[model samples]
Target: MTTQTQPIQAYSLPTPNGQKVHVMLEELGVPWVYHRIDIGKGEQFAPDFLAISPNNKIPAIVDPEGPGGEPISIFESGAILKYLGLKFGQLYPTDPRQQVKVDEWLFWQVGGFGPMLGQNNHFTLYAPEKIPYAIKRYGEETLRLFRVLNTQLEGRDYIAGDYSIADIASIGWAQSWERYGATRAEHPNVIAWIERLNARPAVARGLAFGKAS
Candidate 1:
């Protein structure tokens, strides 16, 4: 009989970036422990947290025994989601073409949508003081990203085959853009997609930190 791997211990927060792992774990229906690493006050920079996530980012995890029983620690929210989805064979496709489609959307979030909107939040709302040019630059770019998403999602329900890694990767961040004063109304498709994602019971629980006591 094949041996089972040791479960991972997750270190995370409720932020969109942090929630990727949370949602993926929920989707995977795995048993794990949560270590809430609060980045608001720089808790992630703590040496111990850094060990699991060298970048000191939330949404990192340590698999007690990975592959050949070696401890596996990883950062990067997108990578984490892909790993879990592929391992579980639940939220991602094993077929090459479908897998690539899922991966494309996942990477889009990490490189395009997430960063652009994050900057939009910074200059448009989070900056100590607003600079018109900065706000305009990021805000327009954020909308453009949304438009790209809207176009891609126009005839699709989920980003890839059924509800795969694409949906899991995008959900968390889409829910929080408004907190940064980033609006989605203009991108009607994105708005509809966000509603659908958060509507999932697993996603709802993940957003609330999953069975908090």
Candidate 2:
């Protein structure tokens, strides 16, 4: 007997992390219902949402047809991308070595690139009083990370192998390079990759969500 899968219930905002899942779902053509959690209004701290996302973050999902046919709630953007990829048999490689390549870049974004860039953004834009030290510190780190990514994309269209979750994980954060005090001129390969990903209809549609309609 075949068990039916239910539409994924996604609670998210339009931030970079949220966009990763949204774009992946769009690219995979997975059935999902999007619930916009307004972080500014503290909706993420609500009892219901907290139960699903213990970390009180956006981009959480409840997959009713999870492993063993049990409903499962997953938090963190990277985990969500991997789960969807594995379930849909798309956007992720079946080969062991190829999977490692994708996983490395994905983890790099989660651990190093995203945090550095986020700190740069906070100091540059949202921080009420800019400490020169903090700004310079994060800004330089962000640029260094950009250079690493640019080198990685020297001849490849995507980060790991093909257009996998690794690219999906990084694109949203890379899109905010301006806020991180980086420029396209310094990272031509990254710019080209961004354009390539942006050209996809699914990516465009995913980006359009949560925008004023």
Candidate 3:
């Protein structure tokens, strides 16, 4: 199967992780279809969705035109972003050094920023028993991570090089700054970067999708 024969299938919702892929696909201008996987409804654990996303997560994708012209399914939002970058030759650098720079921030988000912020969200908003220790721990960590990001963007327009996948990865996570007990006023550089990316038409369109429809 080739992309010409079938559209990319995206299983996701409006969450930050899901928004990452949605924003990427729209930015790449790829032909794709969106299938809302209502995680709140436990649809992520359904057998069919599980076959593609063993972790039972949203933001999985099925590409008809995979490497060697075969269909392939991918999970993990970061991997999906990299796959689309490699496939479309966009938003990622070809040079190994530049690619590494991009990967550094991308992985930073996947490994640190996203998880900590997610924990902060859980403790601050959804946790039935509001554990002050858990909330403070994750909240402080989220702020620390934001400071690191703000420092990284001190003079640059993006986290890594030239608005690549790294920016795409970080934006969704950073969007929850308030919920994570942080403020844009304290992170000027990050706020500037966020505004810059938010102004993009493609990004605006992607962020608008899968929203309570």
Give stretches of model 1 more than 4 Å off: 1-6, 176-185, 210-213
lDDT of 3: 0.89
Better of 1 and 2 by lDDT: 2
Clashing pairs in 2: none
Per-prediction TM-score? 0.89, 0.95, 0.95
Tens-digit lDDT track of model 2 for 25-82: 8998878899999888999999999999999998899999988888999999999999
Candidate 1 per-residue lDDT, tens place, 1-213, comes to 223346679888777787788877876777778888767779988999888788777789887766666778888898788767756667878789888888898899899888888788788767999899998888788767767777887877777658877887778767765654445666777778888888888888877784363
Cα misplacement distance, residue 149 of candidate 2 (Å):
0.4
Local accuracy by lDDT, each model: 0.77, 0.89, 0.89
Worst 10 residues of 3 by lDDT: 1-10
After aligning candidate 3 to the native by TM-score, how far in Å is the CA of 48 from where it should be? 0.8
**Residue pair clashes in candidate 1:** none
Cα RMSD (angstroms) for every candidate in the order listed: 2.7, 1.9, 1.9
Candidate 2 local accuracy as lDDT?
0.89
